[model samples]
Target chain A: MAEQVLLLDFWPDPSGVRIRVALREKGVEYEYREEDFQNKSPLLLKMNPVHEQTPVLIHKGKPVSESLIIVQYIDEVWPHKSPLLPTDPYEQANARFWADYIDKKVHYFGRSVWETTGEAQESAKKELIHCFRTLKGELGDKTYFGGDRFGLVDVWLIPFYGWFYTLETFAANFSIAEECPKLVTWAQRCMERESVSKSLPDQHKLYDYILEHETGQNQPHL
Target chain B: MAEQVLLLDFWPDPSGVRIRVALREKGVEYEYREEDFQNKSPLLLKMNPVHEQTPVLIHKGKPVSESLIIVQYIDEVWPHKSPLLPTDPYEQANARFWADYIDKKVHYFGRSVWETTGEAQESAKKELIHCFRTLKGELGDKTYFGGDRFGLVDVWLIPFYGWFYTLETFAANFSIAEECPKLVTWAQRCMERESVSKSLPDQHKLYDYILEHETGQNQPHL
Candidate 1:
């Protein structure tokens, strides 16, 4: 029997982009169904009843929600090509640790930088820079987050490169490149990959979308 | 060379309890160091510089932080005994999804019920109940969360059983057994295991500690 793979996704969501990169890395053929956050499709609502969110991977009609989980699933199911996680148990745990760290710390603080102003935004900017610097410290002289291999942590974080321009120009006025040069270089390196380049939108395009969405000039997209 | 394992933990912290349970399941013996929250030990800080929180497991002098990540590390390191995660790729993802769900949803709302008052507390209570019911629906008639096997989701969740009495008597005033009988039964079945029973604290003792801690009549523990 042929494999039936479908992905419910949104273009600008870093989470969805992560899944797209993973799918492309695994060379999995999947039907991409775009979700409308204004009125989420019944299929999405049904597939991910728990979250009612996009980036749900439907495999043989079985739904898998959560982007990181989906990517891990993709890696595990299609283990032959473009291995995303380390085979060594300790190394795998380390990769998972950093990926989980990116999930918990980076996104929350990054959003706060652009979404708020005054003391809250200032604190968020500080914390976000601290997070990036910590990530840079972790990266050190390594080619990627998981060392010589472009693996879990890289896949999880590179999509956020799309928001860097907006974060720099629109909100914080702080330069990530100035603060964490190595991480910026790492992002550039990741962008060179076909999977990553295709998955992430142009940073300027994302910036414009953020401006439009914030000013109520454009329809909301999740 | 003998394997040197050390655990920096604080009793009554559900996160730490989760780690203890996983360690017991793996049948690995380790020295347990209780961290004083008021004056965190240098080892704890040095081990987990990012979060600086406990349930940090040190194996061969290297540290693994984050409760769930530590648990996964334990499972991987001690794969020969009491496998915590599923071998099947899809099942592993499913278990991970639910475990992540518990991490995100359960603890936050559970805290809100005990910490807030008035309309906020009422909403938190409602949401916490909704979360429990969702978990119950997931459990259904299964003996354990991972179906027959007491695995990742079960290990991650059973620690919260220690908080049930405190949650029921001092906070929400709702009975989980009444709302989710099957789930409560599942908890009881899990409690029967030595690894779980030993790792989780007595519910009544936890209630007293919470009362004293909230009333500022006792030293704070994390």
Candidate 2:
């Protein structure tokens, strides 16, 4: 039986990138369908009727929504491949906690930097910095957010580094390198991975893409 | 060495009940410290400085915050006991997807029926009904959300059923039994477990507690 894997994703999407990198890490080949939010594919809407958002992994007809959940799914199904989560229960808990922090705090707030301006953007920048500061504190002296392994936390975060150029291009004083030097170093280390380097879209291209379309907000219609 | 486990929780907290039930299901003996949220314990403050919320599970000296996460942690650490999650990877993904739905959609919107009023309350009630309807669609005729086993979705949601009385007391016409009758039946099935029945605070007590404290809103204080 052939494995049928398809990822409904949007380019330069942090959540989508997380799934892409996870699949790459596991060496799982899948069809990548980039979603145009204006004209979303029928399959995507059918697969994820709840959110109707991208980064939906359709594995053998069963659709798994939520990017972090998808990453864990990819890892669990391909357990014999590159293991993303730690085997020890305590370490697994820690991995989940950090990955969740990145999702709930960092990624959620990070996008605001490019979407809004003046006070709103400033507040978002401060919050992103605070979030990164906390992450940096937790990630101190470790090669990856998963300690010695490029695991879940690394998967959730490193892709966001793809937006570093776009973030800097938007704000004059904002610099990820200056704010989180260790994280930047870690990002550099992650980029060395074939899975990560290949999966992430070029940062400059992302900057142009966001600027050209102003499709950055990507907030679902309420 | 005897295991040192403690739960920092508040009475009438649905999230806290989840951990309590999981612990009971595993027959794990541990201390339960009911927090005075007005003056939160210094240990709770130190343990979960990020959110400073309840349902923080302290195992040895380490703390695991977030109810669903804690439940999974408990299951992983004590795998031989009554498992809350499925062993099959695909089933685990489905479990996680629904559990996350319960957390993100059901639990997030369920409390709005009481804390809010006017059009906001009406919309919340509508959304809650819609969320339950979606869950019901997924659940169908299953004995539990895990099909037969009392699993992740059951553990995450049954606690909220304890608050069904509170919701009913708040709104004359609000009846979960009317909107989600099958869920009520599932709740009754869940209550048959000593782990569930013993761990949940009395429904009437929960109603009185919510009335007294009016602490229906536990949103993170920023």
TM-score for each predicted model, relative to the true structure: 0.94, 0.92
* A1-222 per-residue lDDT for model 1 (tens digits): 157999888888999999999988888888888988888999988989998887899999999988888988999999999899998877887888889888888888887777788888889889989999989988999999878888999998998898898888855569899999899999999999999998998888888777778546345443
Native contacts conserved, per model: 0.81, 0.75
TM-score for the A chain of candidate 1: 0.93
Task: Supply the global lDDT for candidate 1.
Answer: 0.85
Give the candidate number with the greatest DockQ: 1
CA lDDT, every prediction? 0.85, 0.84
Query: Worst 10-residue stretch by lDDT in candidate 2 chain B?
Result: B213-222
Chain A TM-score per model, please list them: 0.93, 0.91
Worst 10 residues of 1 chain A by lDDT: A213-222
**For all the candidates, what are their Cα RMSDs to the real structure?**
2.5, 2.6
Off by over 4 Å in 1: A214-222, B214-222
List clashing residue pairs in candidate 2.
Answer: none
Q: How many steric overlaps are in each model, in order?
A: 0, 0
Candidate 2 CAPRI level: medium
